[model samples]
Target: MPKIALHNRDGSSNGTVDLDDAVFDVAVNVPAMHQVVTAQLAAARSGTSKTKSRGEVRGGGKKPWRQKGTGRARQGSIRSPQWSGGGIAHGPSGEQNHVKRVNKKLKRVALRSALSDRARSGDVRVVDDLVFEAPRTKDALAFLDALEIGSRRVLVVMAARDQVTGRSFRNLRRVHLLTVDQLNTYDVLVSDVVIFQRAALDHIGKGSRPDLGQRGRRPSAGTRSDDADLGQRGRRPSAGSRSDDADLVLTGREQE
Candidate 1:
């Protein structure tokens, strides 16, 4: 089990929380993360890059000269690919399908791998719920300053909707705020620090040390239930958690 120092919005340490080993103690899967991130970013691409083929170009209906008598060379339409102003050959079409698919189960594993890496690198932090009486950019800035990430890029995970919190952080270009459901490997890997609201841990499971609450441990390897074999083999179930696996991982997502 791993633990992080919990802090108040004002820069003071409140206590500590345990992180779920399943979520933040697993080995980093670079290949899996790369695959998922690449797919996710591909989905965002408009894939609108386009070029006209020779057949599609205008004014190609007329042949420049008689092919048999042409002195320079045999000629077809002026719009042929060999010509200076001719349509492109083997160029990009606007209809390309850039999307790639990643398995839901593999995506989760990759996400956990990324989060675990962050934990190991000492970039994961926990904070009291970020609630704002009203949305204020200054307050958001101040809040981040308190966390000592005033100018650092950060990923904040909220357990639930908090419009005020969203508004406050929205003004900070470097701070990305997302609900627990929106949490993904791309954001977690790109940011300098990953912060989670105390309540948000419930959604992702604090996986904290037992003293914090439930013994958030997976069944020991020594203990095998009869139904264990019935579940999917070779995949760590999200433990019946939300199916928020990413369609892609972090390979090219940083283009934004």
Candidate 2:
């Protein structure tokens, strides 16, 4: 398992946390990451560019000249493709689809590969929590200063409920804030460093891989053995072994 130092909001060393092997220790897949990133960028295109075709252009109804009288290559219409103001022959039709379909498994692999690459490079940081009293850009800047994250593009992943942190970080030009649900390969790869709140990291480890059978649930103390065994066997832990609604219980115990 990959272990990273956990820090407090003021950048003091608290302890360390073991990252999920499935999410942050996978072998990096460059090709898969490239493909997924390409698809993601392609999907963002609006594909709304359209050019009028020859048939759709106005003033094409009346033929400019008779078949052979004009001796001008038998003029068809003023708006013919050969004319100066002619419509485009083969151009974008506004309905063109630029979206590329990538397999869900490939996307997951790419994301994990990106995160693993960052982890290996020591660009991943985990913070215990970010409980801001209010949204203040000054406090956000101080937080970054404390973390020594000077000017470098940083990706901050926080829980959805932590809107205060989101707002606090939004004013920093170099800081990109995203909820855990919005985390993806492109954003992770583009950032110089990635900071994850402890709760968000736990949620990602448990929920990102649906195949692990740990979605929306925390592994109870009793299921640690099963998790280890599944990790060794390259399979999912038994569903019966996980305890639903255990997040609050586990969080309180861990904090204590």
Q: Evaluated with TM-score, which candidate comes out highest? A: 1
lDDT (CA) per prediction? 0.66, 0.67
Instruction: Give the residue spans of candidate 1 off by over 4 A.
Output: 68-71, 206-243, 246-256
RMSD of each: 12.9, 12.7
On the 0 to 100 scale, the lDDT of residue 95 in model 2 is 93
For candidate 1, write residues 6-35 as lDDT tens digits.
899887998888787667788888999898
For model 2, give the 10-residue run with minimal summed lDDT. Answer: 227-236
Candidate 1 has an lDDT of 0.66
Compose the digit string of candidate 2's lDDT tens values, residues 117-201: 9999998999997768888879989888888888888888765545566567655656766556556777678789999989878
Error of 1 at 28 (Å): 0.6
